[model samples]
Structure formats: C-alpha cells, structure tokens
Target: MAVKDRDRFSTTTRIRLLGEQTAARVYRSQTRRQARRSRLTSRAALLALVLCTLIVALAYPIRQYVSQRAEMADMVRQKERARQRVEQLRDLKARWQDDAYAEQQIRKRLHYVMPGETGYVVIDPDAARQSRADQGAADRPWYSNVWDGVDKSDASDQ
Candidate 1:
C-alpha cells in the first residue's frame, strides 16, 4: 500500500459539517426574529391597554362636568328670576307707601262708602256660590288675601 496522508479529511465529512453549521445559524436567526416580533406585539398591546384605561377613568368625570354645567345654568336662571322679583317688590313698596295710592287700594278692595258717596258691591253669582262652598280661599283674613295679591302683582310686574 502507498503511504497514508493523515492530514487530509474526506470531502463528505467537510460537506456534512458545513450543512450542520448552516442549519444551526438558520435556527438561531429564526429564533431571534421571532423573539423580536413577539416583543413588539407585546408593547403594542400594552399601549392599547393603557389608552383604554385612561378613557375609562375620565368618563365619569366628564359626565359629572356636563351635568354640573347644566345645573349651574339652571341656578343662574333662578337667580335672575329672583333678582327681577326683588326689583318689582321694591317698586311696589314705593307705590304703596304713598297715601293716595294706599287709600285708593283700600277703597277698591273693601267697597268702603266715602262721605256722601254710595258704595255698592256687584258679586258674580258663580263666584259667590264658589266662595260659599269654600272653594275660594276666603277662610283667610281679607288683609292676607290683599297682601298676597299685592305681592303676586308685584312679581308679575317684572
């Protein structure tokens, strides 16, 4: 036999080694890409979750703000009505403080007979019947009804 070349490897062994190295590299690269993709997907999901939480948390406060604004508007309207009523009452008070106006109101309401002047009351039959039936608020004192009428008329002056 010829002398053996111990340093020389077989061609099949070199080819097999190269194929195994390539397979390992491919597997590692695929694993790295999958890991990166999964990481990105997780981050996106977390961002979405945070956004949903923020929306949910602010919903009640937003509703409360809208309702409070409506209530504030109603209160402002009520205040305006009250202010107008106050101004009307002030004007009526000034008018009633006059002697002639007070005497005229008393004469009209009470059907009082002045000196040498005749006073006659013309009552509606239906109203008289209703008053007799207690349907009218005549159980109260006449002055109370008059004062209430004065107050109501003052309010309507606005």
Candidate 2:
C-alpha cells in the first residue's frame, strides 16, 4: 500500500494529471469564448435585419411624400397659368366692351367699308393661294356668299 501511494504521488503522475486538467480548462474556456462570439454575431445580424426592414417599410411612404410634393408644385404652377389666362381673357373682354375696339376688329376681320368709305386690298403673290374672287367675302357682296352656298349644295347633290 505504501508503494502504491508513492506511485500515485510520483512526479511523473502528478505532471500528467496537471497537464490533463489544464488541457480540460483550456478547452472549456475556448468553448465559452466561441459561444459568446456566436451570440454577438447573432445579435449583430438581428440588428442589421431590423434596420433593413425599417428602411424597406419606410421607403414607399418616403417616395410617395416626395412625389406628392412635386405634384403639388405642378398643380400650383398650373393654377397660376390658369389665373393668368383668366386675367388675359378678362382684359380681352374689357377691350371688346369698347365700341371702337369691336368696330375695328369687325372691320379688320370682315374687311368692311362703312357707307361710302373705299376699301382696297393689295394682293400678295407670295401669300396664300386664295382665289381672286374670294379675296374678301365683303368685297363682293353678302348675296354672293348665299349664292355660292346654294351652288355648292346643288353640286354636292349631283
């Protein structure tokens, strides 16, 4: 029994036992470090996923907000254009209210000559190919247009 106890307490046996225990402790510490690293990695991946989801969820509303703002700006511009057009129409209406302006437009557009006033039109060779007789309906006569309309209707029937 003393011999067996001496063998157990021998330097070689003690060194072997200490080495085994140290090896086991080192292995356990490495395993725990790996577990902690894995947990950190998983947490980081979860955080990244959450951030991506939030960005994706907000993307459409953000895009819509920008586009709606642009649409509103376009509408404002259209409204301003419409307002300007209305003002121009109002000014034109005021101009037409004046008897002189109305008379001038009628005379210019219809080529009218009041009573005995002579009206002459210079024919331009480079201008439109209007017929000499149809240069101005007023130049000929009102009855001429009526006759032309009747003639055209009669020709179409044939």
Q: Which candidate is the best by TM-score?
A: 2
Q: Candidate 1: lDDT of 125?
A: 77
Per-residue CA lDDT of model 2 for 1-158, tens digit only, reads: 99989989999989999999999999999999999999999999999999999999999999999999999999999999999999999999999999999999888766787999998877677544767455576665455587888888999999
| Model 1 lDDT per residue over 1-158, tens place | 12233223556666777899999999999999999999999999999999999999999999999999999999999999999999999999999999999899888766566799976667677666674336455554466577778888999998
Query: How many pairs of residues collide in each model?
Result: 0, 0
lDDT of each: 0.82, 0.88
User: Ten consecutive residues with minimal summed lDDT in candidate 1?
Assistant: 1-10
